[model samples]
Target chain A: MKLAITTSGETVDAALDSRFGRAPKFLIYDVESGAFTLLDNAQNLQAAQGAGVQAAEHVARAGVDAVITGHCGPKAFRVLSAVGIKVYTTDLPTVAAALAAFKAGSLSQAEGADVEGHW
Target chain B: MIIAIASGKGGTGKTTVAVNLALAWGAPVWLLDCDVEEPNAHLFLRADSAQQEIITVPVPQVDMARCDACGECSRFCVYHAIVAPGTKPLVFRELCHSCGGCARVCPRGAITEVARRIGVIETSEVEGVTLVGGHLDVGVAMSPPLIRAVKARIPHDGVALLDAPPGTSCPVITAIRGADAVVLVTEPTPFGLHDLTLAVQMVGALGLPMGVVVNRVGIGDNRVHAFCAAHHIPVLQEIPDDRRIAEAYSQGIPIVEALPEYRALFRQLAESVTALCAARRFVTQGDGHEHRGGGETELRPLNPATGASTTEGANANVRV
Candidate 1:
């Protein structure tokens, strides 16, 4: 299974970016292959609007099974759910910890958005 | 002639000044409350025969059969309002600026323009003015389109007084664009001075003639007037910080109607503004830079909007 984690840095130990849409970079990790790839989100970071929707499109195009981030807004959550991708929110501060929790089946899938849009 | 009443800071008496000035003119004029976010001038004008018109902007709708999922429409939208993922495009109507470029750039004739309601425009005729206000629907992030609809109601030959929204942002520019002259309302405090300077830069950048009306004169220093003096902008009228005026304003009554004495003050203000507009236009025809504000000409001693004379240069060297 492959999942995307919104991160501040390139490494898995980087602190998890609380923002899903405007996150600086989204680090994708594959559980079966133990591979890590970086998705640059600089284009949507300072977008005038629709940052959340565009970010969701990026992850959707990357063919990820799920998205793990600190928070998801209404637009992103809607797009993610529409594409049959589960959204898991974590406040674990580090991507390594979040990834471990996900593999251990401890992180629950979010039913809906945790924060308001433009937060 | 179109006169836009604007202020950079909120609650600096922009609505109060616009309403009273329209009434004090004592003639038929188009009073447009262009602040679509929270239109409150209607509470005071209380015009008769309210008529409402719905405002709409064009947004793109994609036909999947013809779209081919090429992502052309998504790439064409500068606002990122349209995006295609997994062979289907999603339209976020809130992010659309109604530019209509997506439909035009569609390759297979798949995209079509559809009307999207942004706001509603209401018009009513009062004794002194015809009040036109734009009410934006909730969750409508775009305001300039609605503001444009409100201004479109102004007659070509008729006079108009626009109550502009606060801050020097896109909404304010959309409200005040094409006005003959702008009246920037401000107070004497430091915050007022700072925002007034920003408002002046914004108006000045548009190459429009503008004047300052210092509201709540006694509350702070005199740096606003000094800034005006340095820029050659005429100090048009001063509204004192009076408890009676505040009380009347709080009760939804216009100052010109409740006080009755301030009527003369706004009338004089109207005359001064007319002179400024006329003189600036006359000079703009020849040399635009030489006669910006028509500074200090025929002000006729405004009876202070109230009985109190605003303290002049209260902090002449305060370095505001």
Candidate 2:
């Protein structure tokens, strides 16, 4: 399955960004191919409002089966769920660690938004 | 003449001044309570036979049949009110600024504007004034559309008094825009002075002719008066820090009605505002050009049917 992890930088070794909506960048990893690509979320970071919805939509178009981050807000949660994508909350230090945690099934899927809007 | 009573800080008595001044006018006037978030002017006006009308903003509705999910609307929308993630676009109505840009940009004609209720406007008649109160629905994120709707109720050439919401935000700008003059109410406290300075800068930046009504005097220093004097902004009236006024206010009693002794203050305030407005009109007419203001944020014009732009306020402090 393809997974998207919010990240502070472009490299998988970079720290995992806790924020989902305004993350600086996103690392999309394909477990089967062991290959990953970066989706810059700088635009979403500057969004005056609805950062969550727009960011979620950005990743949804990329066909991310799951999203890993520190917390998810209501609008982002709704958009991700409507696309049948499960949200995984993690405080893992790096993108690689979060991806590994997801592979190990150590991360729990969020039932709803872990945080309120604007979080 | 339209006069907007506003204050940057809350509870400085914008409602008190508005209600009393309208009552003291001694003539039929339109009193529009633009403080939709917490409309309190009606409590003092004691208006009767309130007729409420739900105010709705026109938001774009997409037709999937024609929507190729090109995401044109998504690309055009600055608020991210709508987005298409391959299959179809999802709309977050609360985020929509109702700019009508989406429908205007739809190349396939798949998008059409639809009414989405934001708040309600209650119109009622009091002894000396027609009270128009706007109440924003709970969880409603936008108020300018509803505030505009409330302002639209003002008849042509009618004497209207608007009780603007506290603060120097878009709502306050929306409430006071196009008015001949504004009455900025403040107290003698430091907080009041600080916010009053900001309000003055904001109104002055808008090139709005305004006067100050110092409420709850005798508490703070004379800095407020000095500041007003330094800026040449008139101190229209001052209400002393009287506990009885507070008692009457808490009881929903207008000072003019409950304490007839203070009626003269409001009367003089009304006259001052009238004279200020007349002076401004004279200046504008003499100049042969409407003073468009000192690079103020281009407010969402009085286009009720076409919900105007909220993005302009990013430059609100542009001139200030």
Candidate 3:
């Protein structure tokens, strides 16, 4: 299974970005291979509005089964859920830590957006 | 000729000036209330609407049966109103700008336009003055389209006055875009002067001839007067800070109708505006700048020392 994690840096040891939409980068991790790839989210970081929706669309197109992030806005949450992408929240320090929490089934699944749109 | 009454600050008497000017014209004139968000001129005029029409903008509707979510529509939309995550695209109608880029970029022809009503325009007449106003639907964020719809009702001949929204934004631009002249109404306070500067910059950017009407005079300092003089902007009219005017306004009575003596003042305002518009026409024609018509021109901030027409200066100061 593949999962996406919002990160502030390119490496797995990079700190987890609290913001889902304006995160600096995204790490797509493959659970089986234990490998990850980086996806740049700089375009959305500069978006004046609707950054969350655009970022969600970006991750959805990458075929990620789940998303791990500190926060998700209403618009992004709606878009991800509509595409059957499950969203999980975590305050873990780094990408690797977040992935470990997900593996242990300790992350809380978001039933709705964790934050309001435009937050 | 078409004249637009605009103010940078709210509650600066834009509606008061527009209504009184239309009434004072004493001819079959058109008064377009382009402030669709909070149109108040209709309350004062009490015109009987003869025609009404709904204003709408086109939004995209996707056909899911086409069997492919190419993500072209989402990628093409600058506003992010459309998002294609899987086999279907989600459309958020409120954020749509109706640019139709998504529909045009779709290769499968799966996207079609659907009209979404955002506002209504009504035409009415009161005492020989035709009143046309737009009322935006609640929660509708876009108002320029409705303002355009109301402006389209303007006739080719005779005079028309547009009561522009009180701000130097897109909606205000839409209201005053093609006017022959603009009257910026403002008070005498510091806030009034600050906003008046913004309003002057906007009209100057459009290269339209503009003058100032200082409402509620004698209540604040003369900084507004000094600014106008320094910029070579004409101070066409000054309405004193009379409690009676406010009393009359609260009762939905136009000053011209309430006092009757103020009619001559408004007439003088009309004459001054005509003269200013004529002078602008002459200047543009003589300099061969009329052909540019709302196009790129030099922009500079108003330097009180210059004391010349700052139209080009204002145009140059525009950031974009």
Candidate 4:
């Protein structure tokens, strides 16, 4: 029953995170303990050589069951999906709003697959 | 002395440094732009074209008349550019790294390697400097081969200044190998700092001795300086944040020519690079880890026993 939540660090509140790996910054919150951790993105590590895979591995190792972010690129989505991680989308700027939606059971796991596009 | 100017992010003025340094030297300094994908050095240093060569990569094209749909060629491709028997073996030309394993394993000898034009290397003289650059064809995937073409054009006897591609990818590796010294151009911003860290790692991984040049020095946080200090990388020169410089760039002129005062700064940059090259040679000749992985990161077939091709993934479209 460990839900790994991804949050954009706009405020000290919960916001829906739709992006899988390339989100500007990622906050991993433990649902049961309410303990939160921020991950400075290493997505640009080696500049697309191992950027996506490295970030995905770090997220996976943190035991995040679900990821919330702005968007998920195809490579990260494939890696996370293969490991049974549910992703949720949110437009909220901060982490507090995302947690509120999760607590209210209003935040739904994203139904579609992560699509790849350059921004 | 050979100097390489590289940046982790594009548009960070690698070509600008190389071109200006060549001008500062006044001698026939060899300027080679290894960016390959979008070489802008020519746009700045107007060169009279002395030579132009077409760069090509080996791609396996199936001869339908000779082969049955055995799927062996498809199986042999590590990139999975070739699909299995049901459909025409789809080749995502961009994704293909051009290792030629598919052609090697084809039982019918049906796979013939056709040279696909990837880019071109043009060599010329500009302001008494030998200028060379590889211009990648639009929509072409590979760059290392074109970079190789540019490297081959490097004159052996003089000071060769190489303008490397942005980012620490395969092409960057190809450009930086055997470089006597590297100048990492960076800005003083958060994004610049982040990418600079990766570039530092990449140059360190290659065991290439490198220095830093802070472009637009006073604009962002001093994180770039702090990073260089922590890493012990020498700071070469800081190009001032000026609008005239931008105007000069847009007008396609080297700042050394557009603004003569900057010529002295580039001259010093060239001098510093020579010093760095000497220092690296001294240190490396004493140390055992002197340039091990300086060649291409080529991926040939893993093992003949593993049936020529391995499963890339279930999602075939992920490749082609």
lDDT per residue for candidate 4 within B1-320, as digits (tens), equals 77889989877778888888888986778889888888888898775555888888877788778877676766676444554423334444455678888778878887778888888788888778878879999866668888888898777678899999898877888898778778999999998988888777666555567888999987989989987876677888899998999999999988988999888898898778888888767755776634433222222222111111122322211111
On DockQ, the leading prediction is 2
After superposing candidate 4 on the true structure, give the runs of residues whose Cα lies further than 4 Å from its correct spot: A1-119, B48-50, B86-92, B287-320
**lDDT: worst 10-residue window of model 3 chain B:** B303-312
Q: In model 3, which regions exceed 4 Å deviation?
A: A1-48, A69-71, A89-106, A114-116, B48-50, B285-320
lDDT of 1 by residue, A36-77 (tens): 999999999888788999899899889999999999998888
Give a tens-digit lDDT track for model 2, residues B1-320.
Answer: 99999998999999999998988897888999999998988888775478989999989899989988787898898788887666567888889988998888888999999999998999888886899999999998778888999999888987999999999988899999878888999999899999988887667656667889999999989999988877677889999999999999999999988899998898899889988888777766886955544544333221111112222233345421
Angstrom error at residue B286, model 2: 0.6
Scoring the B chain of model 1 against the true B chain gives a TM-score of 0.88
TM-score of candidate 2 relative to the true fold: 0.89
Between prediction 1 and prediction 3, which has the larger lDDT? 3
Q: What is the lDDT of residue A61 in candidate 4?
A: 61
Instruction: Tell me the interface RMSD of every candidate, in Å.
Output: 1.5, 1.4, 1.2, 10.2
lDDT string, candidate 1, B156-209, tens digits: 987899999999888998888678788999999999998988787666645567
The DockQ scores of all candidates, in the order shown, are 0.60, 0.66, 0.62, 0.03
| Kept native contacts, fraction for each prediction | 0.57, 0.57, 0.71, 0.00
Candidate No. with top lDDT:
3
Model 4 per-residue lDDT at A66 = 79
Worst 10 residues of 4 chain B by lDDT: B300-309
Candidate 3, clashing residue pairs? B298-B316, B299-B315, B299-B316, B299-B317, B300-B313
